[model samples]
Target: MPEVTPQQHALFEEQGHVVIGPILPPADVARLRQAFEAQAAAWAAEIDTPLDDYLAVVSQWTNVWEHNPVFREQLYHQRAAAIAAELIGCQRVRVFHDHLIVKPPHGGSTVPWHRDLPNWPVAEPRAVSCWLALDDVTAESGAMRFMPGGHREPVTRSIDFLNEAKVWGERERDAVPVAVPAGSAVFHHCLSWHTSPPNSTAGWRRAYITIYLDATCTYDPTRAAWHPMAGRVSVPAGATFNEDVFPTLGPGLSAAHLATLRGGAA
Candidate 1:
């Protein structure tokens, strides 16, 4: 597994977010892209709305691993999981969920500034999201802008992405846009204030994000009672997330255990 450098660790601790990678090889990036296309096509066929219209309004697909084998394998990506654990300073980390967000060229809307922990159902704020770029991303192509050290702020209510702005009174000038090549990733804290502008370029902007929480994080329905993944949790409130659904990942997590999680996908 890959490791975060001392400097990278320090930066993440101070800034609430840090870009790392190409953690994935070109081959892995290509495979993920192919899987995305396949999943998109499947979605298009099932929806009554035109694919373009759907892309414009609902460009995100959650827990894609359940429907796609490629993503199922990627769900256990050791490098990403290891880095997440290291950054969180947790002995183990477990999946909260994964989603693919695509910003169609000149079509997608701006994602308003917000902190993720406020929207999650987990009890603690100890979590990190691995945002993997599936396409070369730039400021004009919908790359995320993050407020440095924003995670230090107290957790609050979730933002209305369609209407709210200045969630924490963060100044736009202080925020920094982060762009990366395909296969690279950005690891960000759960409470980091971040947002992305609409894609202005002709090329699509795609990102696959896997959120990992400290294994000790427990369910807290009061945080986000209507979270999509809430229904998937078998445990009661204040209990650790069900390991069957959110498999743990770390040094002692063996390949056989991951294979068990993969089942047929393995």
Candidate 2:
């Protein structure tokens, strides 16, 4: 992850989302691509996922860190975790979840505009996602479109990702297309409003996204329990999430904590 400067921080504060370019080295990007492909090959058939189009939403393995060594390493990668912590202004961050969203070439399903927070169990606004591109993404190739500064707006309900007819009210004009190269990432506040179009190009659009929450984040029982993580989190409502599941990724995390993370990856 590239360093987030004061200016970049300010931009993120204002826009609710910021695109950081070419963060991973070329080699790392290539390695990640291979890892993602391997993960796809290993699990694509095992998982009984149904798709209307050539799209996999929240696809592949949800806890990819526990399944693949490469993804596991990157999930807790210091620079990426550091960037996540800095962006959220938290000393420590916990893994909310990870995703391997694969949009195959031509006729990929459309992802409608919506905020990520309303879809999750976390309550506080200190969570963010690091979306790492595995393939070159363009606007035509289903790159996510974001509404700048959308996080500052009121909490909006999550909508159907396939429905595009719903109006955005007055915020439609501020939407911007985010196109980034492989090895680059788009860091967006969890509440930031975003969506992506169908992949019309010849290449596939794959992204590995890891959501990080403030270490102190706890469950909000009021939210819907659609996500599998909500079931895995052992702590009761309002309790700090269990460390074994959401390991701390930051400076001075105890060896016990690191051991927990290692055991998870192993």
Model number with the top TM-score: 1
What is the per-residue lDDT of model 1 for residues 234-260, given as tens digits with 9 covering 90 to 100?
999999999877878756444554343
How well does each candidate superpose onto the true structure, as a TM-score? Answer: 0.91, 0.86
RMSD of candidate 2 to true structure, Å: 6.8
Cα displacement (Å) at residue 241, model 1: 0.4
lDDT of each: 0.86, 0.78
> Candidate 1 lDDT (Cα, whole model)?
0.86
In candidate 2, how many Å is residue 194 off?
0.4
For 1-266, candidate 2 gives per-residue lDDT tens digits of 22576666777888887778677898988898888776665565466544432134443458888889998888877777877777777668899889878778785677777788888888787898999998999999999999888788887666755554447787687787899889888899988888888889998888999999988998886775877787887888898788887888857344464444434323
